[model samples]
Target chain A: MPRADARANRAALLASAAQRFAIDGADVALEKIARDAGVSIATLYRHFPHREALVAATYAREIEDLAEVPDDGSGSVALARWLLRFVEFARTKRALGDLLHAPGADHPPARGVLLDALDRILTRGRADGTLRDDRDPADVLALLAGLWTLPDDDTWPVRADRLAGFVLDGLTTTR
Target chain B: MPRADARANRAALLASAAQRFAIDGADVALEKIARDAGVSIATLYRHFPHREALVAATYAREIEDLAEVPDDGSGSVALARWLLRFVEFARTKRALGDLLHAPGADHPPARGVLLDALDRILTRGRADGTLRDDRDPADVLALLAGLWTLPDDDTWPVRADRLAGFVLDGLTTTR
Candidate 1:
């Protein structure tokens, strides 16, 4: 297969996987994914062996598409702004964010990148006195996770932002 | 049955329901609850004819037990302490709390008393300038629900308290 064709095939597979996972959750079948992607079962199996692998790959693609920290001294403000974007990402993707974070699941290759990005933001906030220094980045992530736990509705973003503001204030220390 | 025997049966059933819900989530069988309570299946049916009735009863009982909020006049300090206690109730009950908050799930009869208690605390805090006057008490309950969203582990209470403090700070307008 040509390089372009292989890239297109992977892209189609991921797009369909994201759709299926969104509609039917992470238990979607590989064959169904291939059917939805307009690819053969052999093509699907060639691209990914199992459900966990497919979920990890699809989520990694989604994470990579998220906005990264701007290379400026805007500090914690930038971190808070980026977190609002992250909350939107969690809302639109629904349970996929939790699926990615679900423990004992197969390891994703990009987990380190995700955690490091979070660590960088919190570390910057602490240094700049915008966020409290008492908690770890993982706790920050867990607190932000409140978005995914919300009810699925049109008002999700509104409520999620309030929760985000609450978390941001929690991370910011007095004096 | 005598009134004394009937009340004893009710207490036993509620205790067993709480245990089963804490262990097996909201989907526990009524018959199992009856057996656990050492009562006849007919007795369980007589007490709670449906799943929602059983859940409402269990949640009401828990809320009643947790309504011992101190009337101490420390403003948001009092509110914060009460929220910490609420977090403990939610943490120990785990997913059962989620079931209560699920869409279309009816509030237990005692929910009014709990809400009133919380509203009084928030109202007092606002009067003392210790908490923000803008956010609704309903919103506060929804935000503090971040506790139930955390992982069920020994560290959960400590993590929950930290998150609660974050929310409390957000609710505070003073400094």
Candidate 2:
């Protein structure tokens, strides 16, 4: 295969691996994943040294890239919008969240980067009078944990949004 | 031993077993339980034929008697007080909750009776204009699941109460 083609294949494999792992859990076999990705097992192994590497890379890819935080909105509204997006992420990323929380799991790649992103959004919200100055990012994270407590029913999104709104209310004093 | 003394010893043994299981989980040994309760192993076995039986009895006993809900207050206030008490019960009776939730565990003893008691409280609140008329008890239980998501710090009770208030707000429709 051409060098560029191989790199593209590797990227495709990584993306597919993440989706499969998120949908089917950690025990999903590499053969099935490679097959689904339209690549061979040998190619999968060449790109990822092992299952953990693939899992970590997939998770790193799954986390939202923070370079897109809006620079031109009221901070509180932007923070609320950001938290709503995060709640959606937590609800849909259940499999990734489970992996990150599993006992004795390896650290996901670029965890610091993710935390830094969250910190930046929160700090900007506080500085701009959008978010309450008294709240910690950790507390906000803890409240967001409630998003994952959603039931598997038709009303899940509605209920999760309501709970997220409550959290937002608790975070801000003036709102 | 006298019959009354024998009954007292049996009661003490079960209480100790409940405390141990709640604090240490289901894996605690009978011998250790007997030692804690100052009872003989044979006596413990006489009262409870197996760990499952012991677990069941422990759960049943903890929930069999709850403090009476005051009839004089508005339904919402009454419901709030009742939920606080229930949350306290959950805090102290962690083992019962664990047994009920453990995968593949047998049906918990007297769950129907306990659930019925809870339903009555909610129904009374609804009838008396304390709780929202349309809220389902099942949804209340699901939302209460968020309580366990609280972080294990000294602030847990305070945070848990706030979460309960958030759910109560959703359950009510003041507007």
Candidate 3:
């Protein structure tokens, strides 16, 4: 396959893997993921040599997604958007928890990446006076740790949204 | 022993149990607790038949503390004080988690009590125009769930305080 085609196939496989793993759990079949990604099992295996490889790759992509902040012109808006994305990331992370925490899982530095992302948004917000300067990004992140503790049920998304709103309100300056 | 003396001894045992459990784990020696409470082993046993009983009683007392909101005149101040007390409760709850979650352990209705306490404060705050009327007490409780997710260390108190501050700021009305 050409390099571009291979890259596209790889990205497709990762997206499928993330969705399937979240819905079906870490033990989800590789063939199902390949089928969902519109690729052959051989192609999936070529991109990811093993199940752990696929999981690690999916997790890395999620972190990268979080690190890429959307510039909405206003710091508060950007941070708010980023926080909603973080909620999605948190949901996926919870689904991947058992596998991620399994012994010796090699993945990117998720905490550092998330903190860097928050710092970026906070820095911009502070400069624009849209966010409170007294709040630390680390503290904001720590407060959000509640996302992991929420019950996984039909109401999960609503609860997650409310939690994010609370954090956002706390971070934003009173204008 | 007289009724008043028995009551004082029981309260002393509970206080010592809460302090010791926070410092030590759930399996800490009962003898140490009895000594700390200045009561004999028989007296401790009289109040609490078993270790589970003691843990349950301690948890009950913690919930009661949370339910008893301080009338600081301002609803925000009252809730703020209650929240600080809540941090302490969360810490003890974390320490007592294993015993509390053990099979068939009976305890008071913690969630109902906490929600009722929050409702009381929020009602006053909303009436006095000190807190945001748009916020739900349940959502506030859910947001404060982050308290349970924090790491237990020296910095735990500081992080807990920050988390409480964030929730309080989100719940309080802007003047």
Q: What TM-score does structure 1 among the candidates reach?
A: 0.73
Runs in model 2 lying further than 4 Å from the true structure: A1-57, A64-68, A97-135, A169-175, B1-20, B25-57, B64-70, B94-143, B165-175
Candidate 2 lDDT over residue span B1-175, tens digit each: 6599888987898879877987785678889999999988998888888877787777665566653556676667766776787778766665554343322223355544555655776787778766666555544554565455444557767766766666666555453
How accurate locally, in lDDT, is each candidate? 0.71, 0.65, 0.76
- Which lDDT tens digits does candidate 1 get at residues A1-175? 6689878988999999888888875556778989999999999888888665677788775677662677676446766787777886776676455454443224355555566777887788777887667877656665665565466677777777877777766676644
Ranking by DockQ: 1, 3, 2
Chain A vs. true chain A, TM-score per model, equals: 0.81, 0.72, 0.64
Write out the backbone clash pairs for model 3. none
Chain A, model 2: TM: 0.72
Compose the digit string of candidate 2's lDDT tens values, residues A1-175.
6699898888899878878876775668999999988999999998888876787677665465532577677666766887777767666665554343321223344433555555777788788776667555544554455455454557767767766676676555463
lDDT of 3 by residue, A1-175 (tens): 5699999999999999889987887778999999999999999999999886788788886667778987768899998898888888777676544332221223335555677888999999999999989877767776666565555677778878888888887788864
Candidate 1: Cα lDDT at A109 = 55
> Interface Cα RMSD for all candidates?
4.0, 6.1, 6.9
Where is the poorest 10-residue window by lDDT in model 1 chain B?
B97-106
Q: How do the candidates score on chain B by TM-score? A: 0.83, 0.73, 0.63
The segments of candidate 1 whose C-alpha lies over 4 angstroms from its true place after superposition are: A1-17, A20-56, A97-114, A173-175, B1-13, B24-53, B67-72, B100-116
